[model samples]
Target: MRNLRYVLLAGLLGTALSAQADPVSYKLDPGHTMVLFSWSHFGFSHPVADIGITDGTLVFDEKNPSKASVEVTMPLSNLDTHVPALDKHLKEPDFFNADKYPTITFKSTGVKPLGGKKYKVMGDLTVHGVTKPVVLDATLNNVGPHPMTGQQAIGFNATGMIKRSDFGLGAYVPKVSDEIQINITTEGSVPKAGQQ
Candidate 1:
C-alpha cells in the first residue's frame, strides 16, 4: 500500500513538470517573413503582389499543438504589384481603400494538428473593414536555432484562399476572378530576455 502511494506521487510530480513546459512565444522577424498574394487578371494571366507584415506574435507548442496560436498584422499600404500605376489604383476607394482601412489582421481561432508538422489553422481575417473566417493549410518548415540571431526560431509556410467579393471588393468579380490566393512564409524567433 505504501509503495502504491509512492508511485502515484511520482507520477503526479512528472505530470506537473511536463505541464509547466508551456508553449514558447515568438516575436515575428518581419524582415524574414514575406506575404505574397495572387489574383487572376481578366483571365489573361495571374498577377502577384508582395505585402509587408508589420507585426505579429506566434505561440507554438510542438508537444501539444493545440496550444498553438498566431496573431499577424499586415500593412495594406505596403502592397506592391510591380506596376506603379496599378498599385496606386488598387489602394483607391474602389479597391482596398488603404486610407480608410490601413491594415489587415489575422488572429487564430483554433489549430488542429494533421500528422507530422502539418496543421489546419482556422482564424478570423479582417480586411477592408470586414471580418471573415479563414482557414490555412500550414506546414512547419523548421524549428531550431536561427543562424543570425541565434535565438530559438520557428518557420512556417501557409496557404489560404479568400474571395474579394466577400470583403466588398466586387468591382471586377468573375471577370477578374473573385478568388485570391494568399501565401505566407514566416520565421519567428524568441526575443532576448529584455527585448520583448
Candidate 2:
C-alpha cells in the first residue's frame, strides 16, 4: 500500500511537469516581423504596403496548440507603400489618421489547430480606432535553435483579409478596393537571461 501511494505521487508530479513544459513564451524579433498588405487600385493595379512590428509576444504550445496565444502591435507610422505621396496620404485623417490612432493591434481570443502545422487564429484587430474580429490562417514554419542567435526560436506565416471600410478607413472604397489582403511573417525567440 505504501509503495502504491509513492508511485501515484510520482506519476502525478511527472504529469504536472509535462504539462508545464508544453508552453513557451517567445519575444518577437522586430527586425524580422512584418505585415504586408495589398489592395487593388481602381481595377488596374494592386499596391502593397509594409508595416513593421513595434513590439509583441507569443505564447505557444506545440503539444497542445489550442493553448497558444498571440498579441502584436504595429505602428501606422511604420507604414510604407514605396510611394512617398501615397504614404503621406495614407496617414492623413482621410485614411488611417495616424495622428490620432498611431498604432494597430491584434490580440488572439482563441487558437484552433488544424491537421499538420496549420491553425486558425481568431483575434480582435484594432485599426483606425475600430475593433473587429479577424481570423488568420497561420502555418508554423519552424521551431528550433536559431541559426543566428543559437537560441530557441519559432517562426510562422499567416494570411488574412480585412475590409478598410469596416475599420472606417474607407476614403475611396470601391475605387481603391475596400478589401485588403494581409500577409504576416514573424520570428520570435526565447529571451536570454538578463536580456531585455
Largest lDDT belongs to which candidate? 2
> What are the TM-scores, per candidate, against the unseen true structure?
0.91, 0.94
Q: How many backbone clashes does candidate 2 have?
A: 0
Q: Give the per-residue lDDT digits (tens) of candidate 2, residues 3-119.
A: 999999999999999898889999999899989999999999999999979989999988899989999999998999999999999999999999999999999999999999999
Name the weakest run of 10 consecutive residues (lDDT summed) in model 1: 17-26
Itemize residue pairs with steric clashes in candidate 1: none
TM-score of candidate 1 relative to the true fold: 0.91
Error of 2 at 86 (Å): 1.2
Question: What is candidate 1's CA lDDT for residue 37?
Answer: 89
Stretches off by above 4 angstroms in model 1 are 1-18
Tell me how far the alpha carbon of residue 131 in candidate 1 is from the true structure, in angstroms, after superposition. 0.3
The top-ranked prediction according to TM-score is: 2
- Cα lDDT tens digits, model 1, 21-70, are 76889999889888898989889999999886989999998889888999
Per-model lDDT: 0.92, 0.94
Residue 152 of model 1, lDDT score: 96
